[model samples]
Target: MAFACQRDSYAREFSTVVASCSPAEVKTDVNGKKGILKGFHVVLKDTLLFPEGGGQPDDRGFLNDIPVLQVTRQGPDAVHFVQMPLNLDSEVHVTLDWGRRFDHMQQHSGQHLITAIADLMFGFKTTSWELGRQRSTIELDTPEVIPEQVEAIEQTVNEKIRQHIPVIVRVVSVDDPEVEKVRSRGLPDDHAGPVRIIDIEGIDANMCCGTHVSNLSHLQVIKILGTEKGKKNKTNLLFLAGNRVLKYVERSYTVEKALTSLLKNGPDEHVEAVEKMQKSVKLLQKTNLNLLRDLAVLTAQNFKSRADRGPLFSLHRKDGDNEFMNIVTSEIGTEETLIFLTVGDEKTSGLFLLAGPSELVEKLGPRVAELLEGKGAGKRGRFQGKANRMSRRPEVEVLLREALAGWQPTEE
Candidate 1:
């Protein structure tokens, strides 16, 4: 289920893939040990067996012409599974996919840069990290970073990249005197042998098992994508580096170009243009509302010609806005007159209803709803519905009258 990229002494030969296998084609091994026979090939998983799960991705490489598809830990054993069939006991040439390996290196190194910069510039330490696709994150020792401070940190990291500092990798015994010189806070307790330390010259010296470039300059660039508040006293800083940084820069340029054209402004004026358009849109919205109100008054005057002076009445209007419905309903609804309006789209109808002092809603609303195969409910004076396929307003009017035949006024 996982691949382990072991940062072992054997890792010096970066091109070889190591794996473990048995001579016999056995499906299950109870002892968790495959029977050893002559000429069996072995592939090594990149992960440590005992440490188990971590955020690190597994190593993928080729073992003696067989592709080491994945690396996993089975009990105490780190198993490297191969993809191709191979002869038992044949000598194999192992090679890791260096592109993937280097990618992890860049990300891990970028994390060091960000975390170190946070501590140096802002007095914040990184508590954890999440390596992700397109971007990675470092959880800071503190809860929040202000915009100006974040910008400063970004500036600092980029400055370091430009410095192209030497990155030194040292394998030292846990009890070695040099271990005390390392500034990285935590070392895995389970590590029994020599520990690996990555030193970023004057910037950082941290304990790490992940592979890294010989120099910080290989990282090319470090970019801060964004940051968000995490759990108590923690903040997550998202970032990218190397090829990812290049891609991000390219994408940002493309977006800037599109925005410039849309706003009809040069790059320097685009931001101002966007703000101006936003203000214009708000003004247009207010003007539209005033126009709707005036139109509603005219619509109500036109509907007055159809009033029957009956206790319950209905009206229909084609292609009217919501304001027209509001004006008519508010004007005609009273103690004796119930009102209904149907607004139809191309394929369906919208019904707006208001009952008077009587419980005309209970009588007429359900009948109209059932006839149209719709659903609606209301209190003493209001109801609404969407009739899915009902097109004719006269049909709804007939159903409403029949349902309200015995309706009578009642006090609230």
Candidate 2:
């Protein structure tokens, strides 16, 4: 199907003939959320909605006021996917999401300018580009993009944007000699009909099938955020265009102000203050751990002196860490001593530990797990495991007390 974007991408609204409308199965998002994406693929006689292609996202809008969620090109057709079905012959009014469409225009057009500059200035061709919701990226052919070169490119591109360069889209023959002027690797194997060439006045021309702004000034600004090492040692240049740059600037200031208040330091000194605070926290954590170990030993001694607990002693401590509880049991146990300990409270589930006679360990291990919604094993007269149901701690305690009732300790 022929599209208006192939000629004039700035057309916000246009009505066209409906060639075909049918249900479709679409789940092309690479790392998308799980769910069946139900939509109707409507083939139009002509369209202004740019179908997702050539590293650009699809245009989102409405058809007869019904939401057109996705658009894609399959073979020769530009498929408009809507939530609800539309009549085959009805002339539907297509409305482009103006804000989203313009944003895409800024980024896609900005990318073309950047790609041209990078190739012309540094001989680094863009391998690919991603038009993200928050930020866009261009993957370059080279492993390294120096900071100085990035700055140079920024200076040059922003100058072009300020110049308000004219972007002209012209459809040409596939074998036309002017096609050689396009700074493209080549056309696609499945590509047919006239080739669309996007020419930035006095800057460069490239073959692409994505929507772009008519004037470079509409981009407002292009900010090269940073760069990272990408697949096969390529340099991925992170960037923001137009409203996204403004969005980033606003978020950065908000975060900076919040951090300044929280850390009790000016934005300039935040890094230094954070590093100093981290060092102090490490020292305090060491002291705190030593104190906890000492408290565990003292708690064990206090439990042993309690005449009310009898021989078969049991304890329940909320939010008790299992490893530290083991250390406590080591201090409290004797050959005849049987201690069943469960940790955590009703708000959350936690672990249980049982240390006792081998016979008792084997008998009660499975029972403790069953009561607390957990599982474990008994070894060397000790049984320990984690429980999933924290509120059932009391039930485990009741079951243990009933089992040990009328029991007499045998001679070791």
Candidate 3:
């Protein structure tokens, strides 16, 4: 059975009687997120909606003002999934989303043009193809499609589009001899009725189930964006056709304008400007790290030189890192005094280090880590780890103070 969509791709509206309506659960994208759609599967006596098949998506439209979420072919019938159920056998007005249908037509037809030209020009048979949301891809049975070949194929495709050649759709019986003459990957086991063939007048004739334009000029233009590496020793050629090409150009221009303003350079110089900026940022980061290392040594010396220095010492630097904390501990020599060092935000997260008598450091490290909401490991006389609650440092200090009061150093 040939649905009205395949018979006349340009038909936008039609009247049909609902043959059946049943509860169904279909997968659909809701606001960019994938989710299950609980709906009713509607079958019509005749439908203008095209079901998903032959690498093209299903049609989106309306049935008596209710949105049709998806259309799928079940055996020989086109099943329309809708959120609201319609009374069975009721007459309903079906409206096709013209914009979506036309876009699919342009892309689908454009694909046939590119596929035919590639095969004729370079013996690159299309192993498979995908009609994507933004751009479509044709996977060629080859390892790579070089720039020169891409250019030639793209040129030929657009040339045919400009020639305004006629695109004819013919429906024939399954057993017809003409069916064997057209190109086909194969038909589904569930396929029934006649086979539909799409002929690009003198260019190519292939069996396809997707909707397409009536003439090559309807494609507007086809742009081969580039190629991507494909699996199983193949090359995927990326392309945009019709309005997609226009949208791509508009987006590219907008990005170029924004980059020019930010980089203070023309579009041609934008790449060079960004490269220079990255190099300068790297140099500045190196210089800042060197200064921090020197400051760490100075801070340690200041703590050691204190005339009233006690058995305990503590310091925190929000701008410092693990390397800075280790350097300060190294410079101060933690053999006599218990040292506590932290670097990063005072209220949130940071790294901490503790160094002192081997016995005392091991005992207090766990408790200190608990107060600071963290964990640490130690050996000999040094313990270090990351902390999540630097704001609780005062509590850790109190614990250290109590432990120190009861501690006695063993003679070495």
Model 3 global lDDT (CA atoms, 0 to 1): 0.93
Q: How high a TM-score does candidate 2 get?
A: 0.87
Name model 3 segments beyond 4 Å from true: 28-34, 295-412
In terms of TM-score, which candidate is strongest? 2
In candidate 3, where is summed lDDT lowest over 10 consecutive residues?
Answer: 403-412
Q: Is candidate 1 or candidate 3 better by TM-score?
A: 3
User: Which has the better lDDT: candidate 1, or candidate 2?
Assistant: 2
lDDT of 3 by residue, 1-412 (tens): 8899999999999999999999999886879999887989999999999999999999999998999888999999999999898998899999999999999999999999999999999999998999999999999999989999999999999899989999999989999999889888988999998999999999999999999999999999999999999999999999999999999999999999999999888999998999999999999999999999999999989989999999988988999998998888889887888999998899989999999888899888888888899989888888889899999999888888888898888777
Per-model TM against the reference: 0.64, 0.87, 0.82
Pairs that clash in candidate 2: none
Highest lDDT: give the candidate number: 3
Candidate 2 global lDDT: 0.84
Candidate 3 has a TM-score of 0.82
Measured over all alpha carbons after superposition, the RMSD of each candidate to the real structure, in angstroms, is 9.0, 3.2, 3.9
Model 1 per-residue lDDT tens digits across residues 177-259: 87887766565454455777788999998877666677778888887878898988799888898988888889989999999
